[model samples]
Target chain A: MSEELNVSCARPIGSEVDQGIDDSFVIEGAEASKAKKEETTMIMVGRKAPDFSAPGYHDGKFVNVKLSDFQGKWVVLCFYPGDFTFV
Target chain B: MSVDSMFVHKMWDEEELSKMVDGGIPFPMLSDAGGRVGTLYGVYDNEAGVETRGRFIIDPDGVIQGYEVLTPPVGRNVAESLRQLQAFQLIRAKKGAEATPSGWKPGKATLRPGPDLVGKVWEVWKVDQAFED
Candidate 1:
């Protein structure tokens, strides 16, 4: 699969995502502006959770976690405010 | 998870979170640096350079089943999240044959959905049935 993300802003769908072999999205050139972003809606129920890969801390270890890593399991992503600080 | 760096997450886990929950956060504390992921989810506050509190329940299909995003001062309801998760699972298992009512809990009565049951839901599903289990 090509590493480049399509320009249209629509998410890719189907079996490519299920197997976790698909390339991650890389938005090149045009940056999505803040003004444009305000028009973007929150991800709704039944829509695909945008796939992401990032570093995470767990059990005294740091590992890179991808949303696809937990496919086929119910995942609850609880995003809280900064650690050690009250929100 | 927020815009904190990986090392900050380590410190928070070792210094603070461990004191609250046994052995620190039970699940991975992801570092969404710059609130990139948060931005995609519409929880990022660019002006503050931080991501607000948010919770998303994604089913096995990678589809979002439920989500809640909030600003500060309002605490998240863990019980409500669990209820939603259970309800989503039940509905998925039933393949749309049945539906859980308000405040539904596991083992509680499930309503069979159909045209005939549209207005008759009250007859088969009682308010008391939701609290039975």
Candidate 2:
């Protein structure tokens, strides 16, 4: 990772990010922004949930899992690059 | 704490994960096919067509209470997420609409509602009664 590419996460993507071990790079910049510039006036504290219906391989047959399906449950929605790897 | 699992799809075998269970990794894994959920969550690694590691703990009310999107090649803490869910439930039950302070833990003091209480919650056990006015 070069020094110029090691900018902090104060700015959004396309600014700069750390390089992965494989020489690959991923952005860790700000994913959200606020309307005001001051810290006290800023209010970007909530998460935005996504909606989709997709066929999941459940019970040996494909079933759909929609965002609304888990409406009443606390959803721990995670995303991983690939399974089986350490990450 | 009630928590559901959802993950982006990648080729993995259940048997391998089962063998590593006792090694400290906890929680069930779900698969998100075709990077759809990854794109939606803004954690998709576009060049690789897979999601970078990211975690979110949504409350039963469907509000996200704990979230972390790690840079690629970095794993997440499943146990930490579970702990967060428990704390979030306890706080939500006691505080309702008021927000939780950073690093909030169970049995700790919380900020009360109303303008008079602003900045009055100095610590977990030192809430000034005057702010209740």
Candidate number achieving the greatest lDDT relative to the actual structure:
1
Compute the lDDT of residue B76 as modeled in candidate 2. 69
Q: Any residue pairs clashing in model 1, and if so which?
A: none
lDDT of each residue in B1-133, candidate 2, tens digit only: 0011222221233336546545323433444545545655556666876667777777666566767878766666676687678777776777675545555555554566677666655643344432332
- Quick one: best DockQ, which candidate? 1
How well does candidate 1 reproduce the true complex, by DockQ? 0.37
Positional deviation of residue B118's Cα in model 1 after best superposition, in angstroms? 1.7
Compared with the true structure, model 2 gives a TM-score of: 0.58
In candidate 1 the C-alpha lDDT for residue B47 amounts to: 90
What lDDT does candidate 1 reach at residue A39? 34
Candidate lDDT (C-alpha), each: 0.74, 0.49
Number of the top candidate by TM-score? 1
Question: Candidate 2, which CAPRI tier?
Answer: incorrect
